[model samples]
Target: MNDKPAAPAFDRHMLEALVCPVTHATLSYDAERQELISHAAGLAFPIRAGIPIMLVDEARQIKADD
Candidate 1:
């Protein structure tokens, strides 16, 4: 394998427009996990490569207690 890291897919402005389906809140992209987290909603949405996996089933639920 080349072992070279891939470049960041989305920038801050792009992420700013992304919203949580469950809560309709803003999303914070986690490049490491490739997941989008909604802190207020406590949900984690997965991002495949540079694209977001916006499906509900693909998303992770976050509890307020977490």
Candidate 2:
């Protein structure tokens, strides 16, 4: 499954200015999944093509332990 080309790196610096839309809390980067994890919001905002999709509707619903 590791056949695809590596994706563009997400700018880690942007994390400083970005926050979870739902909770207005800090988000953590999940590099492996290319997502921004919002623990407070219980969602994982996906990063596609090096861009973070902060919209709640586009986020994945996550379990507490996830």
Candidate 3:
């Protein structure tokens, strides 16, 4: 029997409703990285267990090269 907890499922509908807290711009989902990318804010908000951490303090600054 599997003992590990199931990972939370990401909802596409919810993703469409989310915006960047800093820029109030639309966000793009990076499914491979499990992050929400904000081009206007130049930050990437991480999604842990399918729950997006939208706080800027918790987000990673995006590089030009990225």
Candidate 4:
């Protein structure tokens, strides 16, 4: 059996339905970093392979300019 779970496929269109868990603001996708940025909240939600990790506890705190 595989030790790690496979990443789920994230549909780009689905981004429209996603909002920042903290601020309830829209998110912008960073293709290079594979993350969803919530500038309002100053947080970066990581996108693993394709699936986005939306949990606030798992998100990385980011600088306003980042």
Candidates ranked by TM-score = 2, 3, 4, 1
Best model number under TM-score:
2
Error of 3 at 28 (Å): 0.2
C-alpha positional error of residue 3 in candidate 2 after TM-score superposition, expressed in Å:
10
Task: In angstroms, give how far residue 32 of model 4 lies from its true place.
Answer: 0.3
Candidate 2 lDDT over residue span 7-62, tens digit each: 78899999999999999999999999999999998999999999999999999999
**Residue 50 of model 4: what lDDT?**
87
Candidate 3 error regions (>4 Å): 1-3
Compute the lDDT of residue 38 as modeled in candidate 2.
Answer: 97
lDDT of 3 by residue, 1-66 (tens): 879997797787887789999999999998889999999889999999989999999999998567
- lDDT digits (tens) for residues 1-66 of candidate 4: 768985666688978999999989999988778899999999999988788999999999999888
User: What are the lDDT figures for the candidates, one per model?
Assistant: 0.78, 0.96, 0.90, 0.89
Model 4 scores worst on lDDT over the 10 consecutive residues at: 1-10
- Summed backbone clashes in each candidate are 0, 0, 0, 0
TM-score of every candidate: 0.70, 0.88, 0.86, 0.81
> How well does candidate 1 match the true structure in TM-score terms?
0.70
What order do candidates take by lDDT, descending?
Answer: 2, 3, 4, 1
Tens-digit per-residue lDDT, 10-38, candidate 1: 55577868788877888887777878888
Top-lDDT structure, candidate number? 2
